[model samples]
Target chain A: MAEEECLTELELAIQVLVFNFYKYVPRRSLVRNKISKSSLRKMLQTEFPHMLTDTGNRKAADKLIQNLDANHDGRISFDEYWTLIGGITSPIANLIRQQEQQNSD
Target chain B: MAEEECLTELELAIQVLVFNFYKYVPRRSLVRNKISKSSLRKMLQTEFPHMLTDTGNRKAADKLIQNLDANHDGRISFDEYWTLIGGITSPIANLIRQQEQQNSD
Candidate 1:
């Protein structure tokens, strides 16, 4: 492939990664083995109450759920969960999201 | 397919998203048109210095660069760049990462 083509392909590869990160992960309804908020909260409340209080873990979880629950159905599907909290909360992650959005348009 | 298989597949899908987020983005060599530190700093200094100070943007950028520069080669390959700030800094995104690493091992 030409140099430009390689770059384009890499760009595409990057996009695939980004789309998966932004679109797929956030939207996932659940991860079977992964810990859930209620479980984590319970664990934190007892085992690491300091962490919960210091990090504002409860509030953070709320924010995470709000961001992921795109439809506001009171519960997040796994995909919506990932998008909001999956690859989010960082500038570069947001960059991937912003780029994918731009590309789709 | 059995219900178990579907759940496993979804778990795998989630892993792929996480592995890609953690393994790829923070490790990126570069994004062609994305803003750079110096440029961002300059922009912030001029146009949005207030925001820079307000959110500790400069510090956040510093933290971002450090996290992404995995190889410490002085400049980020976009891949390395993405991983650090790409899909990190969130509990859910990090969960993807933690799972993928666990699965791989």
Candidate 2:
């Protein structure tokens, strides 16, 4: 019943990540599917405020965006966006595992 | 207040993906951090039932595992695990975007 009416938790989470990328992609851009560096900064600040606080600082955000822009094209493609999310998750994932271990002990 | 008390939505989503990998890793393996093909199949069946129904077919699941095992090690490392999640999300993302556009129209 619930399975038929709604997506699984993992599916919903994946959608959130994907939808966030499209949210900032400019509709009128020639490359409408990708997000520009400036738009990425704004998206990070708004959607991931707690995860990416440095987005408030233009230089810091630019540096971060540059790392995610693998093609050096000044735009974040879906693959680049996925990479950024992976980068953010890796360290936090370790921290979470540590916490879980502590609590289980 | 909420930020201090709990992880942001994106962070929680990331943790779910990470923890799912750890859940299937065998505790007594020489390589505890990575998941074997068998364990990965079990995980896909249990944690991603809707998304990975083909896991019930042993051959299909093994084929999927082979593709995700990037280093030919027969084990799924964190990077490999991330790649699998990315692969699953990409097509669903396009579908979701189409649905959203239709709703807005």
Candidate 3:
């Protein structure tokens, strides 16, 4: 059986979210386990195409990086990256649920 | 076109994660937008089958709730829920990447 066949929905979802982080960090930078601002901007554009359409823009992406680069290291660590994802997902989650309710009504 | 078709991989993954939280919260408690300890325990056992096998046990799941109930509300808010998901995913992410490297070698 395929790996996904054995996984639950949430398990697979977590895997997708986690693996997406690695897609941006280069192999050489695996030791640091962080993505640069440019890589993050690219990730926002490609991976988060719909959810973060505004931040997918170059200037807005830069602003996001500045706000989320908690340690001022000029790079985004896994925790910081998770924080960014959570921050973005929170409001969108509310909106999505509201739309669902409206659709069902 | 279907809604899922329009979403990027990351967007769908986020939706799965976010909506899972609501599955545990009853409609009556919708205003609070939080889930109780028992609900969280059920969520962990059902949704996070692979990622949190140990916590699938009732005792371990309760321990997890205690730790993550940041406001001591005996309930888990969306932020707390996200934190728990992130905390669990972070270490598993490292392990998964390492196993991938080994498999590719």
For each of the candidates, give the backbone clash count: 34, 0, 0
Writing each residue's lDDT as its tens digit, candidate 1 over A1-105 gives 123233332233333333344332222333432334444234324432332343344576556555544444444333443343333323334444455556656
Docking verdict class for candidate 2:
acceptable
True lDDT of residue B105, candidate 2: 66
**Could you tell me how far off, in angstroms, the CA of residue A57 lies in candidate 3 after the best superposition?**
11
TM-score, every prediction: 0.23, 0.73, 0.83
| lDDT by residue (tens digit), candidate 2, A1-105 | 125435566655665687677877776652346788877767666666655552233444456567766567777777777877776655555555566666656
Q: State candidate 1's DockQ.
A: 0.03
Pick the winner on DockQ between candidates 2 and 3. Answer: 3
lDDT by residue (B22-50, candidate 3, tens digit) is: 88877776767778977877787787776
Give the residue spans of candidate 2 off by over 4 A. A1-6, A29-31, A52-64, A100-105, B1-5, B28-31, B52-64, B101-105
Per-residue lDDT tens digits for candidate 2, residues B5-92, read 4556665666568767777766554244678877776666666665445223344445657777656788877767786777666655
> Interface root mean square deviation of every model, in Å?
17.5, 5.0, 3.8
| Number of the top TM-score candidate | 3
- Residue B94, model 1: lDDT of 42
**What digit string (tens of lDDT, one per residue) describes model 1 on residues B1-105?**
123233332233333333344333232323432434444234324432333343334566566555544444444333343343333223334444555656756
Q: State the lDDT at A55 in candidate 3.
A: 29
Ranking by DockQ: 3, 2, 1
